[model samples]
Target: MRQLLYQLIFFILLGIPDGRCLHMVNFFVPEFANRGDKVILECGFSVNDREEELYTVKWYKFDSRGKMSNFYTWTHSNQQPKKHRIEGVKVVMRESNQNFVTLKQMKIGSSGTYKCEVTSKRRNRNPKYFHPNENPPRFNVIEEEAKLQVVELAREPPEIQGGRGNYFYGDDLNLNCTSKPTYPPTTLTWFINDNRVGNSLIEDDLLYKDDDLYVTISFLRISVQPNLFRAGEIKVRCVAEITEEPIKASMLPDKKEFKLYQVKLPEAMKLSTQTIFDVPLFGDGCTNKLTKFILVIILFLNFMF
Candidate 1:
């Protein structure tokens, strides 16, 4: 229809007739930043005219209440907002590219609708025509609102006590681990050197208290022991898993180390006037003395001395 109108105008202006052509250029400014942020508004030009003409461009901003304001202007002599408020926001022509506008250090008050207005200039005509429709046609520049959020870091586990005792191989070992509660409850797992242990039974009896600030008390009860087990310093470890990583507090052995010892008593006691010399040197029998001969000899030696 615009081409038809231009052809009709050309027929009226001159004696030539041409087919109709309709061209519409739309403005688009998708999103903007908040205060202390940067933004770039784009405005492109499209023309449908037989005569090549020069185009003039300008930018405006509108608010939610439909209040319009001239935030930026682009033409032969560039014009910008005069209010001291927008001084921090520097609008650059984007390296001599008239179609794009770059604003830096944008402020919250600069949030509004922006329109890129372009006016075209014809060589022979005094009246200028804007390539983009100036009426109800403009790009909107809007500043997004900021929001505040609080994030709590993972908490440390509490000190553990009791539950220490002799654990025979294959006997069930139950250990209690506790910690402060965390958002999206922390994942818990038990590991034996890198092997994952299941928690179906332990999770069943997990208790919570203290305004739920206290984390889920995990009771790890291992029903089986590995083949490397012994009464020696077998590292009985309790690892609490929060997140994918493990936070561990091992079960240290008591101060006194355990050792196996054996003691054998003599089958019978030998009684004689003289000392028995057939007893083994390392046997318990060496610790006891024969009575009659030893006592009499000791008395005679004392009298001689």
Candidate 2:
């Protein structure tokens, strides 16, 4: 009776529930990653007793839609790791092992929750913990999971349309700004003379594309004023960016800005008129009509005299 009580006390002290021997020690997974980047996922575990041996290690993934599937597995008996074919998951064989995996060229579709499962089994019975009359589970499994987010940034700068020409006072300025297709769609903002425009003057549109990407478009409409022009030109800027918490301090947000200059209507009209009238009409086989008429009259007088 005293030996059974001691064994119960020992089990309680060790906090071993349901004869589980494998314990997760550490799990390392990056929360954010850019597209086409390489990432490493690591799992560390320990067994409660020396008689327990590692049986197998498996890695599973749950996509954004909560569909679960196994991607990789390693068994102690085989001493080799095997990879399963899955879309958007490229495992580097030379860099992966039983405890960690290296994934290269990550894609936006790789965003999901990843689980690491470790299983262990007892090869021999421990005299102190195991009794002939008591039955225990042969295998124990422990699992840990982490979420990862993969993003694709815009490749080009923002584009501004419909604001290319000159603007006059009291005329309505209508412009549209568009950003390249990217994951987690970019945000478009409008600025006039360095002043940010409010939502009332802006209209937003989003276009969905293949591979879970989006193209963002924004429209700006406001009445042109003399104060908007500085030094005979108006500065119109459109900025596109992705707003999210940075995973690293050195990682900056993806941003692109495009600016266009619109000349004042009067300045543009003056330039147009100068371009039209600046050429001499009397050059190269052309002469002043008044001078020609005077010369003809003088010749006529000379002939009469």
Candidate 3:
């Protein structure tokens, strides 16, 4: 219809008839933004008419609930509510909405559907000998939509819930990993000595403390062997990774890194003197008199010195 309208106007302006030639152009690209990131949404259009025209651009927001509201409008200047406040969000346009509108300090609340409608109306003059019914006027309308998702960065590292323990041989170690609630939720994994805990049975649980927060707790139970760690310590760590299922594939996933937890190995039982004593290292078989002999020898040596 736009091409037909252009042809009709051209024929009338030049006082000639040509109905086969027409042209149209359009461009559309969606926008993506992260939480607290500065974003720019673009909406551009073109017209083939040689006559003077007027273009109007309006930007609307569709919230998470699917509710839509008009927020900003531009004809040649700003024409939207001034007193209304959307936290840390603003729209900047130059040359037109052709360049795009900026959203500053974007937040989670800034997410949703952003609709930009560019409508161009041509002011076609009626030829002196033409009738209004000869050509049905056409108007240009282009609507582009972009969905913005504000992803919150993971804040808290995964923490061990219970305190340190005295794990001994044949003991079953139960480690609880809890990560600070995060957007897009998080998966908890247990690691021992910088390796994933693969030999244990793990149970997962989730707790919702806030709308933006989704906490996950994982219980890892593994058999402890006094042989595996004879003396030093056992190092365990928990990693909380933001699942990409909730976010688009195009966006980067967030993750939290936690420091390792060092659990000291239990001390070995002391050997008692009664268990083995009075045993001579050198020439004696039975040492009942060796202690006395050794004591006398040490005393004589000291006196001589």
Each prediction's number of clashing residue pairs = 5, 0, 0
Which candidate should be chosen as best, given TM-score against the real structure? 2
Sliding window of 10 residues with minimal summed lDDT for model 2: 271-280
lDDT of 1 by residue, 1-305 (tens): 99999989877866332222212244456442433445666666654364323345556665545665555555534443222124233675443244566776554345445665665443332236534444333222212122111112233533233344444444455655554453212444444433455656455222332221224455666543444234322343344333322223222134333221111112231111111111111112222234445778999999999
RMSD of 2: 14.1
By TM-score: ranked, best first? 2, 3, 1
lDDT of 3: 0.55
| Residue range 106-137, candidate 2, lDDT tens digits | 98788889999999977545556766467554
The whole-model C-alpha lDDT of candidate 2 against the native structure comes to 0.71
What candidate 1 gets wrong by more than 4 Å, as runs, is 1-26, 32-35, 48-52, 76-89, 93-96, 125-305
For 277-299, candidate 3 gives per-residue lDDT tens digits of 11112222234357668989999
TM-score for all models, in order of appearance: 0.30, 0.66, 0.57
Ranking by lDDT: 2, 3, 1
Q: After superposing candidate 3, which stretches have Cα over 4 Å from the reference? A: 1-31, 76-98, 127-138, 170-172, 193-200, 209-211, 227-233, 246-305
Q: Which stretches of candidate 2 lie over 4 Å from their true place?
A: 1-21, 126-137, 170-172, 230-233, 243-305
Better of 1 and 3 by TM-score: 3
Q: Counting only residues 3 or more apart in sequence or on different chains, how many pairs clash (N, Cα, C under 3 Å) in candidate 3?
A: 0
